[model samples]
Target: MPPSSSTTSARSSRRPRRRRPQGKPQQQPKRSLFDEVGVTAVDPAPFADLGLPARLVRALADNGMVEAFPIQAATIPDALTGRDVLGRGQTGSGKTLAFGLPLLAMQQGSARPLHPRSLVLVPTRELATQVTDSLKPLAKALGLYVREVVGGTSFNRQVDTLRRGVDVLVATPGRLADHVRQGTCVLSEVERTALDEADQMADMGFLPQVRELLDLVPADGQRLLFSATLDGDVDKLVDRYMTDPVVHSLAPPAASVDSMEHHQFLVSATDKQDVLARIAAREGRTIMFVRTKHHADRMAKKLRAAGVPAGALHGGKAQNARTRILDEFRSGATTTLVATNVAARGIHVDDVSLVVHVEPPADPKDYLHRAGRTARAGATGTVVTLVTDDQREAFRTMAAQAGVKAKTTAVRPEDAELARVTGAREPSGVSLVAPKQRETPRGRGANPRSAKRPDEPTRRRRPSERGHDDGRRGQASSGRGARRGNRGGARQA
Candidate 1:
């Protein structure tokens, strides 16, 4: 088909391009980070229907927890199949059993000495204790042993427990690191590990220790990370250690539960304490959050003097003292609990009808956590933040960030608006006697430094007490005091 030069050039230039495929090209469906792998559409169901063993079902039913929460129902099925799970849910969302049940069900054999089959790491010692308490009954029903190793307790006792062999171990990173370094614990045999409150662990600067501990576990072991928020260091942990985790996000990053009500009261500096005392004197269990440990102590003392039964819980207190205070509060011996941020996530008490921010929190996360102390587990509750005129703008910003729409008002201690909002009322004028400490005997085995006089207050703020509640590394001291403060101050799990 020879043609003239001009015609041939035009024909060659216009040669039809290879026909392109019609319609949309074949492509794979994009995957979401939080998709439920190996799981399908579901709803809240009974624990019995979730493939949990009969023993666990019976144990849950005995505790009036026959139904699986949304988080539990979503994560359990995948977790039971030995898949790593990354879960994000709000506080009081029944996350413990979401991971714990699967952790227990997967254990087919008893653990050997110095090695546990499963591990749960928490941020605070109080939380560690609470987790242990919550799981002990269920673990027993499964014929398993759950042991907890936390600071403020006997290390020797923890060692003995490990030597005796434990099926499940709940621990704080700091204390767990100590055990690992001392050869009291070996993680090679651990088949499953869960990091509860992983965000809090990151916030408390325990990620380094957490990473080190995770590295010690077998590379092929299953891991579960549950947190209120999932970002930053938590994401890195998932990427590095987990293999194709099943993600379940039940709540937003800063979830303010539907049952929670927020309010900000504008108070003059002179009347703020009186207003707080009145609100604390209301007819219900209340938790008051202050900025520092000293402030918590002073506020409790002031409330007590105003005839309101109150207890102070802060990182500065000894672990025994902290335990005693929490016990008293839980038993209704003290109606008001004044604390620093240390208790924000550690406490899991029921019927906390009111939470007062005597001092505003450092940020939105702290604010939400402080508010989380109340309105827990679908219970209706109120959160009241007392703010001075100068602090109003800052609080507004924090509230906005925390996804809270708090009703703002200006009122004095005697105003009806104050009463209506916070159930504030006048306190009884009779001063209450402060609880006394038992005196330790001066003997050859006595440790004078560890004992406190009966009537003596926590006198001077030791270097360890300073910045203890901040949940940050100390920039000042580098000796054992600083190390002790870092470990014992915030009561990390």
Candidate 2:
């Protein structure tokens, strides 16, 4: 029916009113980023009762993981449900499997070449290698292939492996960024992501690259972030990307301090070098930490000169050399290793009885990680910091911030406390002389340096030259004789 002009004008002026459907409810906003969310405690259970696949349970049983750690039992179920997670635990607390098993259980089919289904990001190459190695046996139980992508390895080999399918990839941020930039691997296909030691990555200034990689993954992809502490930049990461992630905080976030003992030794300036050498000369494996790379090299050289088998490890070394040195240290071929900050968090050598700080670390985190190198896996260890008069206050502040009570002792090179703490014996008087380097064979091998003939007299100097030498020697002798006479006269007077 045609309406009047006034009614039609009124109808055109009115806005269309929307109505809520009867069954649907009103939508609510997501929780605020800073709101305090309650964390759920893990239910007590074994791996079999935790809803893991029989095959994975068998693999866990094979690896002696019959019972779930608190972190695993708490995070696994939620992760399996495809939720983003923020997990916190101590250094040795079973984080690898807490994220790893769930990520593996979700991958049901073959992955496309250059497109992995899962990614694990670590801050260093050593950690990347270890993660890949640790997860490979577990991956094998599920018919998956795990690969490592790191900076020190051949890029071509990594590319080839990516061109062939990789089910799981454990990589450092820098190397993975290279693969993405080269178009060798597409990260958009990554579904499950885990960032191990996220705090260290932030401390290392890799958060930008981490953010870039996170952006490359699909928006719906699940993520798990694990760190010892979350503050500053790490907190920013959680706020921006994560959507209501379940936060799990475990006590004793850093390495356990119960198994560790700390000491600060005060040293005189003149005796510092001798004291360092004495401590480094200990019998069992000892890791020495210095502040700078140059210092690390110099300390290693000095230790070697003092008859201690020491190797220098720093970022300046090539990757192969670093690996070789670490292998030698682990094999007991090198008893002491002098390293900069690179080895503080990366090294995982077992049975390291002592750690010596040639200089105290700049911050508490550095201090804690340096001490954490020892006393691992429930083993006992001692950490000694060589403090001079000037550094005492700074070290005290650092220890306080790290929540440690370090014993301060005034010590000398010959002190018994050094032996009591480090098990260091008196250095053998003989320096560890380097074996003579082999010379490249010369043409026909004629006139070797060892061909000196004892019968042939050395060349004699001319009269003028001999006279000059005699005058110099006479001057030195006269000066010494005059000094001795003066001393005797002074004593008689």
Candidate 3:
């Protein structure tokens, strides 16, 4: 029983298409702003026309930033348009203002003592403080309030600040978690969330905490995630949380490392200590790198003894102690910091003019990280490594592998070139060795006459006694010879 073509089509049309069981229309999952819109780079001149308040524009102009950096130029418009952005840029590429300016512009008419409208999660306490400092002025100008919640600080104060409510909350994951656990701060009201240094957070193993924090924020809120690299767990984070994020990558990852000046000095074992001292005595703040915690402590002690205000940063230090030492270093109360690999990354301090490797690292990666302590935020810096004669080959290999073309030279305490390279005045009264005479034996072979019994005194014999002993020995030999002669004559007779 075959049906005609029209009858078959009529039957198919009459059959109901499976309808997705439609009670409440199955509320569609909220879409991210990036999913719904496309963003384009905009000039800073049009920010006012784009509806940013006049005061913020004046602040930007006063800061000598006439034009936005590439990251800012790319992401600011998207952020202002309430779109989620995933920004990829080098460390000093002005990503802060990329998100910061838009966050400010969006809060023009917000009332005083504002609730948590925006939240920024950072990896380290130092970074949290730095971000807070960078945003505080702008927040203040906008009649907005910002507060920092980081570890190694007063917990009660953070709770109090949260109770008072803040417009922008800058925090580290651990401390922010503590506040959340203590029921002090609420993330439900966070409309705009930013994860600054997302790669750093993953490196520090804070991704789980970051995930928990993100879960607390509203899913529909605008999100901005900035990182140097988007790989490994960071990529997973992006896939899970960020919706169709507009990725804006300004430069390659290693571009910043390429711009630094790396120099290695070949020094003798005896000269290494003096070379480090001279380098630390340079004009601006210098961070000397050592391989071990004990070495950092010892070097810091020696530098302080030599009249340089110095501090030590290493894993062995307590959190409060580390915080205090870093504070002193940043405030210029201490101009020199002797640290292990702990300060090689995630520490951002301005005006660090020099980085000295008292003991150069074995790996090229370590060398680059140590060198990165200086030359931050597009500022020029010098990195000097004091390599002993035996270590020159290894350091050279590391430099080559790290793509650092360093000027290699022999450095000594008195060399004016050392002073010129290091920007340090020669130490006035440094004595390498003690000025004292050492006694030596006159002859090469051990003196038989000098060998005496333990009971005998080791003093010089008197001149008369020496002469008498010699004469007695000569007479005895003559007497024995004469007796032998007489005996021979008698036998002949």
Candidate 4:
């Protein structure tokens, strides 16, 4: 079934080495690989010095960002000059303002409801919402309206908002693609575009759709791309779309990883669940990560039953429900948020003191993102990964790949080290007063096929067996159909 060695060699030999045309003239190499390189944080740099409009500086001050973070200080200057920029910064390195200010400043012209002048594309609905929220104050200071265009909410509401006009549009790629497909969003008028979390976008397999959306925008428009890393995939986007981008990296890709404290807890298989319950029930808002949505849900439910104000978040939640859960977490209404990897870049709330991995991630990058959520913007935090005996070797390999030398501990629920590392407390016996209602993500999937063997075909229904259809418009229903229609109407009433 496999090709012989000789045949493989013959195929390789037959393929000629590709060469340039003999008569073609050699062109000058790119003058600079990038217009700018490695600008570190300019700490204590006031926003006033970044050449931001006075009103924006005032808005920043009112929002308590009187001083710009290092990444923003390094990039705001280049971005404001209308130079195409490629930026990578540590997690919570003030990346949003790095590009947001420039986008609001350099972008020209007003946006009609259906045609925004500036666009920001993110990979998830939560990020889209947070980005819009972060930029709204500045946009308001500038007397401009910025709107979020994402799925998981009413399409008509977004359409209506676009009709009123959107100066800036923050969106997730998939839903934006759907809007583009439906002819609801027009991008030819766009003068600027910003892509946030470039690495996550690539990791989530959104680059294909991101590329298509980029193609729809004007070719000459200014672009700003930011990520935590600049790898081959991100480099592909730079090569294809960005023109002589001024590259600025505040720190290495794993810059934030080094700032957090890493711990590996080795507990017995029987004690794992109890240890986790104690951690989730700990004081201070904690984020617990699981390997799957079901695990996330089941774990959250267990914690809630144990009296921890916990919530579950995964891609399977309706957009509104996701927003509510995140809102509660941010507002401190819900103290513990348990989720899968969906919240990696999707969450950006402040004051998160702990990140617990109920299960270790399969990749080093995921570990970094999960850890990045805590200890953000210069605050120190702890990252704890629980490993049973069976997962020890696997987790060790994962930590090594993630450049983490975790401090190992063999602990039970009452171990002092566990409390010291995670602020984990004894499980409370009180039940959660009320549980937050959850709505499953929109739409139901088709039923699964029967488990019976293929040789055993499912029984078929005869024409008359088709209930109401047999007496009416032959499988089609209209207003005149009274059987099931009455049932639906009665339910509505």
Candidate 5:
């Protein structure tokens, strides 16, 4: 006979509630920040079908962008529907348009002075400028104004632009922080915020400033983060900020473009420079990455002396000088660019057929970014790293970590294989005169003291005298103490 109901209840109660198997309470596996639904491969979609404004579609067509890239097609739909999106694509995957189209489409009305309706935060000034340029035409089609705020440019000009009003503001984390601190800009009205190259921003120690800026936006504002990789601090950002974002990944974490080729050319230290100069004299645009600014400048001089139209780009050059050099490169006036890591991320030029690493980068990410300079937009390109006996092991390890299995070769300055692989050719023996620099003066009075005399010929400085030249000199002014402080804060921010 079954126990009476009351008796059963009393017995169940008397049995000490089954203890929850104590000791740390069986920690549930952590949930991922993204609830990732399967994103199947999507074919290119026409701009009109993506729910974009008719004017925007026309503008895209005018720009010769009739169909969307894979990344653009996948993200634009969800982004237009007002959902947070996490996009991962290799460099040169047309990510700019993916987030940009939706950002412009969501604007309802005019923005107030100093308060933009949309914001795009990038890692560097070059990227900020590029993003602004990319969106300006589209923004105009939608009757929106896009402004760029970054360091190495006029702070007062940025403030004035904000005062007039802006619809979209593209900026680096530091400069944007400086603007917010100076009361020249406000973020409370930002309805959409996109972080391009989010992983690089995190790597550059801008995560704190990025977080601070993001916090100022309303908690409910839509966030769209596009990154080449989604590990480490990037994961932290997604967990803290994104709300069940739809994740779309078009490539693996490390960038591996199908049209890109990687080669490791082993050479002796004595022959490395010769091999590099030969590669620099290649027929098409080539970007050679060096380890230091001094090295970049010196290498450019050496190449110029060899009759290679090479320009140096690094943090050591003034902003105007950097811009001028990059412009020359883009216009085909300069055939080669010898740059430090500064140009690895934002220097996007068409027909860059070759990328050479004069020295191995600090790590795998740098290697990938440096290589990404070429093989852009589905174009075929080659990446060759000049490795000596000492660097082979390190480079091999980095390659393994970066998911690359490059073809190894033993080559000398005169090897036919080198010519076949890299288009190595002898440079003309005519030394080209370094162009005169007329940089935009950073402050008042034109810095007469720092100007070179017209009669004086340019001379290369000794490495010992360089002493870590990072392009900071001649930036401060006698009358602009506040400006100086702001600039300093940006550099350190």
Candidate 6:
């Protein structure tokens, strides 16, 4: 309605302001980085306040592990509060302690025997051993007993230990499934269960066994799953098994290229053995990786013969032997170890200063894993690849794809650079006896000059029968023979 301007202005000024529409309260823009990465940051301070037993906290402080990795910080509070957690982090990012500490702290003073209160399922026996190693001391400090159940060891012994009772059980799915089938161990007592490296187990095709084992545990029990990548079968396991689990992830894995120093040495096949020997002679501990088990054995033997104290680790060896060799290498009883791809995973040793790829791996993943053995726990290291002419392109391609920048050099046995890089010292006065060469037996129609000569008749032939060209037959053959004769003749002339 058209009205006078003054009347409309007065009415509008007198009218109360229209009420603003109330919309849903805006969520502080979900944190951009974590949301973008599809993960959540775990805060560490809350864990300190969560009623953790004093002894365990003291042990943590004593070990200088006061701070937690992102995974640990995120999962510990929920785990201690009795909530299931699904943690995803890269290898070697301290997942063991993140789960281990809380489980131990919560289960303390519960003297349950012959049945495990907590179960940790890993894919390989080596990883089981490693997990047990990391948790054993902490468990001891908290008055808990931990037992390992893995294959390639005495089953009777493990069963006997289980009969005596354990608070924590670290096992592989296969062996654990066997024990459960035989009714030798009861999963009903398990209050907390962890599947460390779940993706790796699934990748290794142990998902069926892992699923069966999970089925044995109580449905309402706390379940913790940790893995590097959670796609494919691992995701299925999480969806089916874990209930409303808190998900935590750490920083994206370090780029293998920028984190390591790569070196490529150009050496003739003949010089490769000597150069490797020199490199193995380095002062600090060194790990030399080869392609096959046979090559690993042969190369270790050769290095030992060349005055390098070396050992070999491969699948062919007994588990005890493998353990002993690894122990010796880690304790500095031996400074060098020659191994195959079997040692690339589930091997953790300290103070390794160099990683030498006697033969480069076929893929960049293997290369990165092999190199990772050296630079660990935030330590500096060097990685060297011995590249022959045939492998140069492959090495270059792998380096490029892996984003590694390598310095190429021609290496020799006595080169100062080799010694400098490997920390090899000049020998004082000792000399190694070269292996003796075997003599070949003289065959029929062989050299008479070198063999004992038997008496024989000497006959003279006619010039036509002798053939003027010394047994030449065809014209093309004769031309080639004549060129060879001319070369000798020219040399003599």
Give the range where candidate 3 is weakest over 10 consecutive residues by summed lDDT: 448-457
Rank order by lDDT, top first?
A: 5, 1, 4, 2, 6, 3
Q: Rate residue 81 of model 6 by lDDT.
A: 86
TM-score of every prediction relative to native: 0.82, 0.77, 0.69, 0.82, 0.84, 0.71
Candidate 5 per-residue lDDT over residues 372-412, each given as its tens digit: 98999879999998888999899989998998878999999
Candidate 6 lDDT tens digits, 1-493: 8999999899988969879999988887333222345756555553455566778877777767776766777778788888888776644557888788877977845535557999998876667889898888888887788888865566567778888888999987766766777777888888889998776676567787888888888999888888755657888888788897877766442334344577888888998887887777778899999987799888877777767778888755555666777887989876889987667755788878899998877866567667878767667788999999999999988887666788998878788888777775542223333233332222233222212111111123478855753554366577979999999999999
TM-score of 4: 0.82
Regions of candidate 4 where Cα sits further than 4 Å from its true position:
1-41, 255-259, 433-440, 443-493
Best by TM-score: 5
lDDT (tens digit, per residue) of candidate 3 on 44-67? 344444445688877766666566
- Ranking according to TM-score, highest score first: 5, 4, 1, 2, 6, 3
- Model 6, residue 293: distance off in Å is 2.7
Range of the 10 consecutive residues with the lowest summed lDDT in candidate 2: 448-457
**Residue 421 deviation, candidate 1, in Å?**
1.8
Q: Which whole-number lDDT from 0 to 100 does residue 298 have in model 5?
A: 95
Instruction: Name the lDDT of candidate 2.
Output: 0.79
Report per-prediction Cα RMSD to one decimal.
12.1, 20.6, 26.9, 9.5, 12.1, 22.4
Kindly report which residue pairs in candidate 6 clash with one another.
Answer: 114-165
lDDT of 4 by residue, 388-451 (tens): 8989999989888777888999999988988888878887868775554765443232111111
Rate residue 12 of model 5 by lDDT: 78
| Model 2 C-alpha lDDT per residue in residues 1-493, reported as the tens digit of each score | 8999999999999998978767867686444332244344565469887778899999989988798888888888888888999887655557888888888889879789999999998887667777887789988999999998776556677888998999989888877876787798899789889998888888877888888989998878898988766767788788877777977765443334688888999998898999988888888889999888799888888888888988888765555566777888999988998987777774688889898888888878888878878887558899899999999999888888888788889989888987787776777766775333332222122121111211111234599977886797699789989999999999999
Judged by whole-model lDDT over C-alpha atoms, candidate 1 comes out at 0.82
